[model samples]
Target chain A: DAGITQSPRHKVTETGTPVTLRCHQTENHRYMYWYRQDPGHGLRLIHYSYGVKDTDKGEVSDGYSVSRSKTEDFLLTLESATSSQTSVYFCAISDLAGGPDTQYFGPGTRLTVL
Target chain B: AQTVTQSQPEMSVQEAETVTLSCTYDTSENNYYLFWYKQPPSRQMILVIRQEAYKQQNATENRFSVNFQKAAKSFSLKISDSQLGDTAMYFCAFMKHGNYGGSQGNLIFGKGTKLSVKP
Candidate 1:
């Protein structure tokens, strides 16, 4: 919580519009992740980055894109917002390069696409 | 496929009482890590405790501890001397060991057990 902050804590947008969520970390951790949480399902990963400019797809990355051009910032973008995309998104970071790292999560951003 | 399951959806405990949340995981890898994360109303996910699969010793953190049965593939959280502040959503997580001596950077989590401590 101290090291992580997420922008747009709550948002409501129309369907077919594009959306972007930003996660900023002051810890300068090597691993930054994006996860979406829903009612019945557990936290599902959308994307993650191991280093600046090095990113990979996660379990639920179908409509999401990410960019990590810097060590402190990671962005998750939705190409076309949909009602199904409405959920709580969390950004987590860890010092993975240091090993056995624990993840620090942001306050989370709630997005609603109607 | 590795999956973590939390059988309890919601639980209630009196103040200063104790409660245990159950978690079971399916994984063939012997080398892995189990974690208990707590999410308060503030929506911040906090690491409550962790247990390395290889270690037989259970993890203890003051009023919180875990009973980790590797052979049984069960990792449960036990809250001793529970307080009102302890009410939150508890999640059980599984992290598989990575090859090439690197971190895989992903965690499999259960649906979460919501605990409510009543005064």
Candidate 2:
């Protein structure tokens, strides 16, 4: 177990509404990542934080934003939800400080946008 | 730009049998890492095995092992003594080793292979 937890394991929202998912870690890991898993797409990186206040965009970052105000918390927000955004979101924390770090994932959040 | 490819979309194996899932990747970097992750019905990504590019020996974890061929840019996973609980969606992923301005620490994943272990 990586000591990671995600809030609101399942959520349903109407289109154009804003949704925010929280990722909290107890291990004080330096890196955190958010990904979405779809049927045909295994998992695509949405956003990742290397450290508090340092973030970067990922493969599928459109309509999504992330924040890392503290070492243990990373938040992912959907500016405006869309039906196409319905999918499973996952939060991961790297076990090490650098590259080739083995990422441990938390139980995903299932979101449905109507 | 690195991409991982898993040609087999679905695979089936009888209980107590062995199965190998093929994964081929394209990359220009010589130093990197290869990984295999399992996602079951629980929806959590579990790390099954990983292989370092510089390592000449294959990595093995109990019943899970990987055939890491750097020359061919192939990293295939072999599951021995497949069990019913081993059924899951297997994903092949790639990560660059150093921080050379590429997608380091970020994993590029293959679509996935749905494996079924039948009794």
Candidate 3:
């Protein structure tokens, strides 16, 4: 659907530094999510937003924070980057209007914490 | 808590052949959804297919299909006439129906099966 796109397809940052990854959607989906995929752990949800200014944490939201100032964007922030946080991050979307909402994913952002 | 398990860490299949990836999930809820996502080397999570628990018929997309045994909590994916492009990391996911179309639920995913389709 060409709904979502994650910026900085790849990123490398030093430890303890803060980094923010952006997820932009064109389809105007009300539901947006952030997930991290690591070897042996599959994909773990970091956070999700159901509407503008309405967001909630997921299973792996400890080291991350999310913001949804607008419906088209959901930003994931790493307060202090760590090697353990290095993984491929994926952004997903779902229609909130109703019905069975199938989640669509973005290409992903490979983050490297040095 | 819901959990998804994929015992097979990896598998291999010859081109134009057939292969099956096994996935089992544990969920207390009776109504939910099951999904299969494919991630190629490009690292994009593509929605391969999805099945609603209320539906008796399994979900199928072209050569890709599923054997959803709701009673046994098993959702296995079958790839017929597998192509080289099918080589990728396949994930089995589960979602329990929440307040509204899973508005309050998150997709619980299994470790994954890395399928290697050889030519």
Candidate 4:
């Protein structure tokens, strides 16, 4: 089951408020990723980390930021939430093996902005 | 940049029957990976199967298998003996095989196809 967990399974906040989502993994994998799932768009990558203190943005990282201070924790933060930012956030982990690295996803967090 | 496409937005199959979900991707890199992920109503994304670009042989896991056509850039998932539990939203994803910062190890996914298995 990848041993992945996301905190605040469901959250609601007002516009302009800052929000952070947590993704924790017990597999000790080297790769972690944050993605948002929206209708008609499916899943879009927001940010990912390859190691501790190493992070980078994805295709739709315009308003999202990420931090990875340890091997097991990766956090995604929205400096200012907007109504359009509401989505189901998913955290995935991969070991980056020599061959194909299959990613395992977490339960996902549903966020709503008013 | 690479893009994955799933033509079917929704599909249905009768229990005990077989169904195939089509996925097409565009990539210029020779080294990469393809995967099919299933997201049930529970909201958990599960890895159903994966096929390596270098390997000609298709990947199989129990009732789940993939038809890898590298030339056509087509990867289709075949589910045999479909069951009620097979109903879920299936996603097709692609990832390049390298450590190129954010681009590496990041999966580009398609819109997804909803599969309904009826009894």
Residues A1-114 of candidate 2: C-alpha lDDT, one tens digit per residue:
789999989999999999999999999988899999999888999999988989999999999999999999999999999999999999989856544688889999999999
Pairs in clash, predicted candidate 1: none
Across residues B17-55, which tens digit of lDDT does each residue of candidate 3 receive? 999999999989989989999989988889999999999
Candidate 1 C-alpha error for residue B75, in Å? 0.2
TM-score, one value per model? 0.96, 0.97, 0.96, 0.97
Per-residue lDDT over A1-114 for candidate 3, one digit per residue giving the tens place of the 0 to 100 score: 566889989999999999999999998887888999988999999898888988888998998999989989999999999999999999998874535677889989999999
Q: Report the number of the highest-DockQ candidate.
A: 4
Q: Any runs in candidate 3 off by more than 4 Å, and if so which?
A: A96-99, B101-103
User: In candidate 2, which residue pairs get closer than 3 Å at backbone N, Cα or C atoms, i.e. clash?
Assistant: none
Docking class of 1: medium
Which lDDT tens digits does candidate 2 get at residues B44-74? 8999998999999999999999999999999
RMSD of each: 1.7, 1.6, 1.4, 1.3
Runs in model 1 with CA error above 4 Å?
Answer: A97-99, B99-103
Worst 10 residues of 3 chain B by lDDT: B96-105
Per-candidate local distance difference test: 0.89, 0.92, 0.90, 0.92
